[model samples]
Target: MPYTLIKSSNPEDFVLVHRFLMQAIQRLRAAGIPLWEPEDVSVDALVKAYGTHSLYLVMDNEKTIGGVFVLEEDALFWPEIVTNDSFFFHKLVIGDDFITKGIGHRVLDALVELAKSHGKHWLRCDCHGDRPRLRNFYESFGFYFIDRKTVEGFDAARYEYPCL
Candidate 1:
């Protein structure tokens, strides 16, 4: 299925994004994945992210299915790298009803194309280090594992996909 990414700017969109993120957080927690805390997805946090990140609502036709945050630079997770040739993806959340339906793959493919259009040489992202399924998902999507590191008190597994 073709998905559209809408850059969220208004307060209403932010509320929707926050709810989507919270649902994702709840799902992860239920699966014993301590990926995100409630505060992490709060409306205020999402609003603050607008200043430094681009928040996008993932849509399948007219239906909103998920959200993602794109950043030009991710100093918190990739402090060792100092280049601007990368687009960092964060908070990628697909609705429970949309999981296991190849939506994740489509989303990543879309992100790759978006990065290429922006002249980004790499697409970088991080997941909880303990989540093997997520790591494998990224690897299967052509992202290579970089390393595991502690960022903001969480062990993160970093991966990067060359936008070639």
Candidate 2:
């Protein structure tokens, strides 16, 4: 299947993004993953994401199958890392039906190119530290495990990919 990557800005696309995230949230909770709280899935958070970050959505035809945020400044969650030199990514959510289909990997590959085009040296992100599966997934993409720390009440494992 052919997938298109789009920068979500219009109200309809924003609504799709919110719905996609809510579906991911439900799937995560059902799988016993404490990756996000109820507050994180709200439309308010979606609006905040739109205001603060560059939101990209992967679409198969008209449906949004996945999305992620490319944030320039992330001192709130990753205070230790200098934000000036790196591109930060968050909420790489893939719809439940689209899991294990290499869509996330493709999205990430595009993100790496996005970082490179912007002259960023590193691509960084954080995930629930205790989820080995999630950690390994990042490692599989050539992202090195940097460190683990508690951020905003969650134990997060940081990963960085050198975009050289």
Best by lDDT: 1
Give the per-residue lDDT of model 2 (tens digit) for 48-143. Answer: 754633777877788778777788768866787764778898888877777765666777887888788889999999898999988988999899
Worst 10 residues of 1 by lDDT: 44-53
- Candidate 2 Cα errors over 4 Å, as ranges: 1-4, 49-53, 61-63
Candidate 1 stretches greater than 4 Å from native: 49-53
CA lDDT of each prediction against the hidden true structure:
0.84, 0.78
* TM-score of each model, in listed order: 0.92, 0.86
| TM-score (C-alpha) between model 1 and the true structure | 0.92
